[model samples]
Each structure stands twice: as C-alpha cells, then as structure tokens.
Target chain A: MIVCIKQVPDTTDVKIDPEKGTLIREGVPSIVNPFDKNAVEAALKIREEKGGKVTVITMGPPQAVDALRECLAMGADDAILLSDRAFASSDTWATSYTLAMGIKKVGNPDIIFCGKQAIDGDTAQVGPGIAEHLGLPQVTYVQKIKEVKEDGMIVERSIEGGYEVVSVGMPVMIAVDKSINEPRFPTMMGTMKAHKKEIPTWGLAELGADEDKLGMNGSPTRVKRIFAPERKGQGEMIQGDDESEVCALLIEKLRDKKVV
Target chain B: MAVKIIAEECIGCESCIDACPFPGAIVMDDGIAKLTDKCNGCGACADACAVEAILVEETEVKSGIDINDYKGVWVFIEQRDNHIANVSLELICEGRKLANELGTELAGVVLGDGVEELTKYCFAYGADKAYLVDGPVFKDYRTDSYTDVIVEMINRYKPEVVLFGATNNGRDFAARIAVRVHAGLTADCTELGIDPETKQLMQTRPAFGGNIMATIICPNHRPQMATVRPKVMKKVEPDFTKTGEIIRVENSVKEEDVTTKILEIIEHATKMINLSEAEIIVSGGRGIGGPENYYLIENLAEVLGGAAGASRAAVDAGWVPHYRQVGQTGKTVAPKLYVACGISGAIQHLAGMQTSDVIVAINKDPEAPIFKVATFGIVGDIHKVVPLLTKKFKELKEAN
Candidate 1:
C-alpha cells in the first residue's frame, strides 16, 4: 500500500501582512491535512491486517520530508520523497501525472490510498486523474473500508445524500473523505524508529516522467485571475423598538426590491 | 468533429431519439437513435439520452474551434404550482448576461401543463424566445417524463449553453441528461464566464471541499451544461412589456411508462427558524463552548427573528443538528444579515457564509478571518455581547 501526502502551508493560521500581501509562515506550524491523516490511518490499518508494507509518497519542496517523517512515525513501513525545484506550481492534472509516474517506479502494489482531495488545491481531481492515468479502478469519497480481500475489497462510498456499498477489484485506488476513520497518534517508539529510518528521495529523471506533462507546461487549465467577490451594497439598518414595526420595515424594503 | 455512440451499453429506450433537435442528424435504428452525416456534432441528443448511449468526440485542430455551430443561451424554466422557481429566474438573469457576452439570443425551455401563460413570464424575465412542452403528463415533476419532453425539444433545436438550478429536481434532471448526451455537466457552480478566445463556457466552483476553486471547460461537448446554486446569482427585474415567441411541442410520455409514484405531498408546518428560507441568520461556533450555551445563540436568533446556524465543529460536538452547520460540508447560506457569534471562521465555514449580504462578527480573537470579511467587528466575548444585544432589543421594543 502506498499513501500520498502533502505538506501545505498553514493557510488558516498564517497571517498576510496587509501592506505586503505576503504570508508570514514563521510562527505558523504545518500539520498533516485532517483528511490525509485518515488516508494514512486507512493504509496503516490495511498493512496491519494484511501483513504488507505501507510506503508514503510526497512530491513537494525539500521541506516536505517532514510530512513523510510524520507518516513514517504513524506506522508506514517506508517513506519516499519526490523533491525537485521544477515541480513547483504544478496544477492538479500535472501533479497527478507526476505522482502516477513516481508510483510506477515504486513497484506496483495491490492498493493505493490518498486523501479525497488535498486541502490546498481542493480539486479532488488528482486522485481520479491518477486513476485515469494508471488505468485502474478508483473509488472516491470512501467513508468506510468494510473488508479487504485477496482479490477485491468492499467499501462504503459517501454519495451526496447517503452512502453506497461498492466492491472493486484489487490494485484499485481509493480516495478517502474525512468521515472515513479517526487517525491514531504516533507512539514514542514509532517516532524514535522513524527518526533513525533513512528516507529515499527521487527526482523527475529517476521517475522517468514526461517532462512536458510533469509541471505547468503539461496543465491545460490556467488561473486567468483570482480576486475577492464583490461585496453586497450598503445595508439598510432599520431602527425600531417594536417587533411589528421592524417587520413592517423589512417587508417594505423587500417589497421595494420585489424580493418577496 | 465526429460524435461517438456506445450502442452495446444502450438500452434502446428511444429517449435519445426523441431528444435530438438537429434535423436529420439522428435516425431510428431498432428504436435507438443513430448519428449520421447530418450530425453537425452538436451534443443536444447525447445530453438528452438517458441510458448513457451517446458520446460526443471532439476533433482537435491546431488552428481553432468553431463555437457558433452551438449558439443561443437557454435556461430550463422550472415551474411548480404554476409559479416559476426563484432559482430558474435567477438562471435566466445569468443566461441573459451570457447571451449578451456571446452576441447570441437568450431562450427559455418551459415544459409543463398549462405552460403557455408561463412563456410571458420567461420573456418578462429576459428570455428572447420560449419553447414550451405542455401535456397532462408534464403537470408533475417526474424525471422520466420531464426528460422525455425536454430532450425532444433539444433534439429539435440545439442550444449552446443550458443552465439549471442546483435544486433537488434540477440536479436529478441535469445528471440524467448529461449522462445521456455524453456531455460534461458542472454542478453547483459559483461563477460562470465565457472564454474570450474560444467562446467556451468557463464554469467555476469550489472543488475538494472549498480548499480551492476550479474552472471547468467542456471543449468538445456541445451545449456546455451547468447547475447554479439558488441565491448565488441575481434575478433580472421583470419587464412586463417584454414578449417572445412561444414554440409548443407535443409530449410523448405515457402514464404507464412512469416508474416512480408520488405517494404523498406532505408539507411541514413553517418553523420560526426556516434556515432554507431565512432572510437573516445568527450562527455560533466552537467558541460558544458547549450545548448549554447554544441557548445564547437561540435567544439572539429569536430576538432578531432570524435562523440560528452552527459551524461544523459546533455541530460535530453535538451542540446542534447537522442541518444547522454552515460550512463546505453543510448548507451554503446567503442571507440579508449574517451575525457570527463566537465563530472563528474556518475556510470551510467561510465558503458557506461568505456570500451573506451583511456580516457582523463577535469573537474574542481579533485575528479571526471572520473579522476580515465582516462588515462590523466586535472584539469581545459573545456571551457578554449576545445578552446585551438581546436585552437592548427587548428594551427598545418595550419603549416603542
């Protein structure tokens, strides 16, 4: 089993200096994505049940090794990092293609698990795109892993309204949602073991990926522009002491706008 | 460009046969529609198909693409109880804008019983043309019946863009049509734009749980499809003098073919806090502490005569029902006044409520993102502020 993880800047905690529009990551700490923790937990559980190795893969800047180490401490058997300067600014399509090529180099496994979608990109496209690139069955928004069998696995998929139970053949890819399972804390012994474990780093050349499709050059979609949505018009504050009077004022305002 | 058809998987339901609007493009082959040379590669037939039989394949030329073969902006004018849904009207306003951008006509696809009078409303709302499909079978909102009639119209006249509301019925119909037509369908889009170069519809929406926004395009698919959330777009003001052509088509669905039954029509009594229809909302978050403090939220909501909402954290803490959660994982609300009490707005929570007309944040943390978006900020404890506000409102009412 191979679990893919990403180390995203803590966008929630980091403050952007209003004057410079630059992020302040100095005081902010990066934590594993809440959803990715579920993915790691799913992989660890599978490894424990099936007696196989769980390797964590990540493609990012050099600092992403910390995310891999966290995965290792969480009980992954091995950790691999795909770090290169050229990999920056990759869109979901390019990111998925690169990850797919790296997974190919790490020997085919019976299963692949990823967070339903990364917190930063939020495309949710990468997991499905990877499945399309790898030509394997993919189940997304998986809430529960009912059973893992030799030939296939049974899982419950989270649909819009409810859940559906599905069975897919082995060597399949599953993108899990946050509702899947609760992640466990890394033990002291496991943390010590991870500190001693040497992590192998791979580059684009070692992965043998098409350079054209591995970064911005390979992505078709472009972010033309991004700006905040326009704020609503000035609000009318109705001043009144009585409920009926306030209600009457609201009704009149709504009628003036013909919203009612 | 040539369109592909998956015949083996097709059920030969003839749903597509009735849906193809292009002349002589689709012919009956053992009750299933087959594409011929007359097919201009317009994808209305594929979208109208129900069993996922039709596939539209686009040919990539190094030079460019022709978008005029698919023209006009169409809004599915959904009606219930002889009244147009607010969402449908909202789409027409949006469609009118898109039509103007493309230098094309804006049209409305109205399908229901006694829909002739409804054409006037569509035109008044901004549609340049109205296509009506009226029959007794169309009186109710049934997926199969509605799909049959609408698909038949598309088979007759191909529209470039089709917009539907992201309501229950709209989503049900849109998904079935997109699958049948083999065209792309972008759901719950927050924004829409026309690619200046290709004249393609750029559908933008929050993907991966509101972490990021993605813009989707169906380069090859004809009649780029999308479903916009209600209240996300503004509805055009009705001009009573506006009028347009109403083309009525005969319905072909029989009562026997409908599989689902409308067992009962039970309407729940309107509640004081009708979140779906509320004009104002006062939401609380984890900072509210526990279930006991939810009373503070409820009291504030009651005084303001608004609905009470909770963040996902508060709801998951068992402090409130899941329906009250305001975030990416919950309902997206756009009310007149949104007061965030003790809610430190997470990105997910912001995605759901950021569109509120007026925002007021009351939190002890001055650095909260909710304060950034809020029109008015009170850096104080909600427990102290809410009670004060409630008491002030009461005193004001009594004095008046």
Candidate 2:
C-alpha cells in the first residue's frame, strides 16, 4: 500500500507576508493536510488487515522532511520525499506527473491512496491524474470499505441522496473522504523511533522525470490574477443592555427588510 | 494574422459564422465561410468549423493537449432510484448556451435502472439530444460501473465540454472519468463560461479557503470538464411542449465487471436538506453553547416555518448532525431570509449562506465578520436572543 501526503500551512495560523505579497511561512505552523492524514490512517488499516508495508510519499521542499517523519510515527513503514527546485509552482497536472514517475521508480503496489483534496491547492485532480498516468482504475470520495477479497475490493461511495457500494479490481487508486475513519494518534514508541528511521529524498534527475513535465513549464493552468474577496460593508447594529430590546429592534429591522 | 478558408472542403454548415464574435470575421461567399478584414485571428471560427476548412496562420497558440478531435457539449443528468435531481436540469439549461456558442449540439447523459421515462425532462430543459444507459447493473451508481459507462460514451462521442452538478455522485465519478479519459477537470466551480477567442472552458472556483476566487482553464485537454456547485446557477423554467431525440446507449458493463455492491442504503432524511432550496433559514452555531440549547434555533425556525441550519463548529461539537452544517464543508444555501445566531462568520461559513437575500446575525461578539455581511445585527447572547425572537415572532403570527 502507498499513501501520498502533503505538508500544508495550518489554516488557523497562516498570516500573509505583506511585503512579499504572499503567504508568510516563517512563523506560521504546518501540519499534514487533514484529509491526507486520514489517507494515512486508511493505509495503516489496510496494511494491518492485509499484512503489507505502507510506504508514504510527498513532493515538496526540503523542510517537508518533517511531514515524512510524522507519517512514520503514525505507522507508515517507509517514507520518500521528492524535493527539487524544479518541482516548484507545478500545477496539479504536472505535480501528478512527477508523482507518477516516483511511483514507477518505487515499483507498482497493489493499492494507492490519496486524500480527496489538499487544503492549500484545494484541487482534487492529482489523485485522478496519477491514475491516468499509471493506467489504473480509480474510485473517489470513498466513505468506507465494505470488503477486501482475493482480486478486488468493495467500498461504499457517498453520493447526494445515499451511499452506493461499488467494486473495483486490484492495482487501483482511491481518494478517500473525511467520513471514512478517525485518524489515530502516534504512539510513544513510534514517535521515539520515527526520528531513527532514515527517510530518503529523491530529486528530478534521480526519478528520471522529464524536466519539461516537472514544474511550471509543464503546467497548463495559469492564475491570471488573485486578490482577497472584499469583505461586506457595515450593517445596522443594535446593542442594548436588555436582550429583549435588541430582539425587538431586530424584528423591526427584519420587517423593514421584508424578511418577516 | 488572418484566417483562410478552403473552398472545396467547406460544408457550408455556417457554424463558424455563429461562433465568430466579430461581425465581419467570417462571411459566407459562394457557400464557403471566408475570412474578411474583421477576422483578427482570434481562432474561434477554426474551432467551430466542424469540417476543418478554416485555418488561422502565424497565430497558432496550441493548448498543452490537442482539443481538435472533440465535439459537442454534454451534461450528466444525475438521478437516484429513478428520481432525477434538479441540479441536472440546471446543467442542461446552462449547457445549451455553451453548446450554441460553439456551434455544437447540447446533450444530456442519463444512466440508471428504470430511468428511461425521466429522460423527457432533459428536452424540457433545453437539451438538443440525450443519451440513456439503462440496466440492472446501473441500478445504483457504482463508481466503477458508472465511470465505465460515462467514459465509454465520452470516448465514442468526443464531447468538447462536459458538466456535472457538484453533488457527491457527480464529484466521485467526475474525477474518475477525468483520469480514465485523460481529460482536465475543475471541481466545485462557482461559475462557468467560454473564452470567446480560445473556445476553452473558463471554470472559476473559490480557492485559498474562500478568501479568493480563481479562474481555471483546461486549455490543452479535450472534453474540458467541470463540476459546478449546486444552486449557484438558476434553473431554467421547463417548457413541456419542447421535445428532442433520445439515443439509447448500449452498454456491455455487467454486475461482474464491478467490484462494489450496496448491501443497504441508509438515506439521511432529505426533508430538512431542502435547506438549500428553502426560502427562509434560522441557523445556530457554537455560541449558543451546547446541544441542549439547539432547540432555541429549531424553535425560531419552526415558528417561522423555515429550515434550521448550523455552523461547522456546532456540528463538530455534536450539537447537530453534519447534514445541517452550513459551511464550505457542508451545504451552500441562498435563501430569501437567513438568520445566523452565534456564528462569528468564518470565511468558509460565509461562502455558504452569504448569497441569501436577507442576512441577520445575532452574536455576542459585535465585531464578528458575520455582521459585515449581515443586513441586520444584534449584539447579544443567542440563549436570550433566540428565545425572545422566537416568542416575538409567534405573537406576531397570532396577531396576523
């Protein structure tokens, strides 16, 4: 089993670097994207049941080593970090292409798992994109795994009105939703051993990835512009000592707005 | 830069004539669409020419992927147990405009068991044609089977554009189909449009946690795909007198071909979720304090006959079920009246309910972000405020 994860800015602690006109990462904390952590949890469960090694991978800067170590503490057996200056600013398509090459180098596993989307990119394309690059069947938004048999697995997929159970053959890719399972806490022994476990960092040349498809050069989508959405204007505020007075004022205002 | 037309290859379909935004760009002379001075090398005509008779010289800007082989626009009409979803109808309505712009046919793809009868609504909503795949294997949307059906149709027909409602099923298979067909997919988009010059699908979605909006385009891939957020677009009024062609799609995918099976389906009671379509909504958050106080929010909704909603914090704290959560992670509602109590207006939460016609916020924090978007605000605790508001509304109702 192989799990893919990314290190993301903790949304709660993010601050913008006004001078640079970008998000400030100097002091802000980072964590494994919540969805990817869930993916790690799903991978750990499958490893426990099926008796296999869970190898995790990530593509990011050198500092992303912290993320790989954390996954090791969470029970992932091995971790790989694909760090290269060339990989910066890659959109989902290019990012997935680079990840697919890394997977090929690692040798194809029976199953691959990824979170539905990353909090930072919020573009759930890479998981599916990898499936396309690797030529494998995929299922997205999986809520639960019903059964894992000899050659395939049955899983429940959440839809609009109800859940549908679907089966797919092995050597498959899955993007799991949040409702799948609750993530486990890293054990004391695991945390103590995580640092001792050596993690490997791979670069573009080592992965034998084409330079054209590894970075901004290969990305098709472009951000023409970006700006914060303007906050709404001021509204009539009612503040008073008595809650009843405020409620009465609110009712009158709702009437004025023709809402009542 | 100039567009040249081949006389012998011209079919005189005149699709390029409609696709040209500039009046004199392409003119029909002797049954051939020819480029005039008005042609600025925008290249929209070349894409619209189904026969490939027109070409623009020295202005060839190729997308990363070849899009020349694709044609038509498709909407996936999502259905559950034979009941068609309203969002699917809205997509057909929206797809018609895009198709007509590109000089192509607009079609709806419907797949399910016993759903052939519901295909009529596709035409009522302006679909020029529809594809129906009916079988016991498609009784429920299995990701593998449904994906196979749609992927087969897309590969065979080669649609230039495909749209799906950002519902769970749509979100699930859309990503899969995008992968299998090697198409580019933009998810949970708030807006959809066509680039007049490039003829590429322009998909705009909220990014950076709803703090900024990003417009994305899959310029290189054929069959550009998007899953637009439900309720963001208005449904077109159905014309019952309208009719169109229904092509029965033959599918060989069988039960054995799929690996997943539904032992049972536990449906979340949907009567409350008509929350997205509700005209009025009264919602509560963590500030009301605990699950026990939730009735205060429910009481206000009941008195007004509106739906009850909750912020993610309230839902996460076990104060309410996830179905009632109103935020980026939950449901997006645009009611005529939205009364929010105790929420401080996280940007993700605001994105869900900000489109309501009337927004009223009640929170102890007077400076909460929710107040900025609110038409009216009250600085008071929800425990006291909600009950008073509910009582006052009841008295007013009795008087009326």
Top DockQ model: 2
lDDT of 1 by residue, A1-260 (tens): 88888887655564443433223345677777667788999999887888898988988877888988888898999989997655655656567778888888888978888886565544455665566567666667777898898977888764323345666777888888766777889999999999999998888778877776665455433433222234334334444564444444544554465333
Q: Supply the TM-score of chain A against the true chain A for every candidate structure.
A: 0.87, 0.91
- Candidate 2 total steric clashes: 4
TM-score of 2: 0.81
* B59-145: candidate 1 lDDT, tens digit per residue: 442213344577888999877767787778889889999999999999988887887888888888899999888877777565567
Clashes of 1: 10
Error of 1 at A26 (Å): 6.5
lDDT of 2 by residue, A112-181 (tens): 9999788765667788788767877777778798877778888877665446677678888888877788
Report clash pairs, candidate 2: A166-B260, A167-B259, A167-B260, B65-B220
Worst 10 residues of 2 chain A by lDDT: A16-25
Q: Write the per-residue lDDT of candidate 2 for residues B1-400, one digit (tens) a residue.
A: 3468889899999988766644556778888777775444546677778888887664222445557889999999888778887778878888988898888899999898888777789988899888999989998776678887888888788899999887767776687677567566777777788889988888888665665566777666678888887667778888878888999998779887676566666666644445765778999998989999998988899888888999988987888976677776667677879999999998668868886778999888877989989988888878888998899999999999
Q: If scored against the real structure, what TM-score would every candidate get?
A: 0.61, 0.81
Tell me the lDDT of model 1 at B137.
Answer: 79
DockQ of each: 0.04, 0.29
Q: Model-by-model lDDT, in order?
A: 0.71, 0.79
